[model samples]
Every structure is written in structure tokens, then in C-alpha cells.
Target: MAKLYSKKKLAEAPKMLPKQETIDFILNYSKALKVVKTSNGTYENIAN
Candidate 1:
């Protein structure tokens, strides 16, 4: 019989949040973008 799982300890990872500038930039830029999916398997940008 073989071992089912590893007995090694996992390391602790730190979580970081996005900067204020990055969040604001994305919010502004994303507002002008529009995406639409057609009958085919391709994505189309319908923003005008």
C-alpha cells in the first residue's frame, strides 16, 4: 500500500490588497469597455 497524502507542513502565505491608484484606474477604464458574445465561440467588443 502507498501513502495517501504528504505529512509535510505547509507554509503560511501573506495576502495583499490592491493599491488605491490601481483600483481607481481599473474602475475608470473598465467603465468604457463593453463585451458581447456572439453565436460563435469568439468575443466581440460592442463599445461605441
Candidate 2:
């Protein structure tokens, strides 16, 4: 599936569309991605 979140699109989007679920999903996905990166050691979790 095409991503519901896109960095480029988000950068240009107006600041209104993110309802609670969208925000929650982004937060959860980011956390999970960080854990995956840490476990694989292929990418650094620079946000920390």
C-alpha cells in the first residue's frame, strides 16, 4: 500500500489534518522503527 504518511507531503500540507489517530500512528510507528533500527544495527536512532 502507498504510505498514508509521506515526509514530502507533510512538509507542504497545511497544519490541520492530523487528527488523534494520525498523530498516534506516527508516534507508534516511529518508536517501532527505532527499535528495529537498534536491533538490526543497520541504522542509527538519531532522534534520541
Candidate 3:
């Protein structure tokens, strides 16, 4: 079902953006992690 939102309601909605700390954590974690591609052409995460 399609629900329409009023302009005022949309404007009042809070900005749904990730916090700086969250982004930093994700970036640091990804940097420390390792990844590789398999024969099927798909990525795999091997953090250990």
C-alpha cells in the first residue's frame, strides 16, 4: 500500500543519518578485516 505523507510531516522528521562514531567504527573494522573472491565470482569476508 502506498501511504502519502504531508510536506510538513516530512519536514519535521528527523534526519536518519549514521552518527560519526558509528561510521568510524565501521570504517576501522572494515580496514582491519580481510576479504577475497571465490571461483564463483563472489566476495567473502575472512576477518579472522
Candidate 4:
């Protein structure tokens, strides 16, 4: 129960968006949140 979005929780979501789409979304989203991108290229709390 973290106050902010947790990466573990996001991992359980359905992958409606493909890999390429996800990558693009993560990049933009991370910038907005001012969070560093993970090695996997996914932003924290980012759902694919």
C-alpha cells in the first residue's frame, strides 16, 4: 500500500497496448511525472 502508484500493481494489468505503443507511452508519461525510467524502459506505475 504505497501512496504513489506501484510498479508491481501495474504489472498485473492487461496488455491492451503492444510493445511499441507501450514504449512510447512510458517515455511521455515518465517525463510528465518527472520519474526516472527503469532499466526495462517502463515508468513506475505505468500500465501497458
Estimate the TM-score of every prediction.
Answer: 0.47, 0.38, 0.44, 0.31
Between candidates 2 and 4, which one is better according to lDDT?
A: 4
Q: In candidate 4, residue 6 scores what lDDT?
A: 58
User: Whole-model Cα lDDT per candidate?
Assistant: 0.72, 0.64, 0.73, 0.66
Cα lDDT tens digits for candidate 3, 1-48: 234553345356678999999999888888877666788886756463
Instruction: Give the residue spans of candidate 2 off by over 4 A.
Output: 1-15, 35-48
TM-score-sorted candidate list, best first: 1, 3, 2, 4
Number of the top-ranking candidate, with TM-score as the measure: 1
Candidate 2 local lDDT, 1-48, one digit each (tens): 356555355356567777899999888877766433455576645354
Q: Can you write out model 1's per-residue Cα lDDT over 1-48, one digit (the tens) per residue?
A: 255465555776788899999999888777867777678766646343
Model 2 residue 3 lDDT score: 61
Misplaced by over 4 Å in model 1 are: 1-10, 36-48
Task: Give the better candidate number (3 or 4) by TM-score.
Answer: 3
Q: Give lDDT for model 3.
A: 0.73
**Model 1 clash tally?**
0
Q: Of the pair 1 and 3, which is ahead by TM-score?
A: 1
Evaluated at residue 5, the lDDT of candidate 2 is: 56
How far residue 36's Cα lies from its native spot in candidate 3, in Å, is 4.1
Q: What's model 2's lDDT at 28?
A: 80
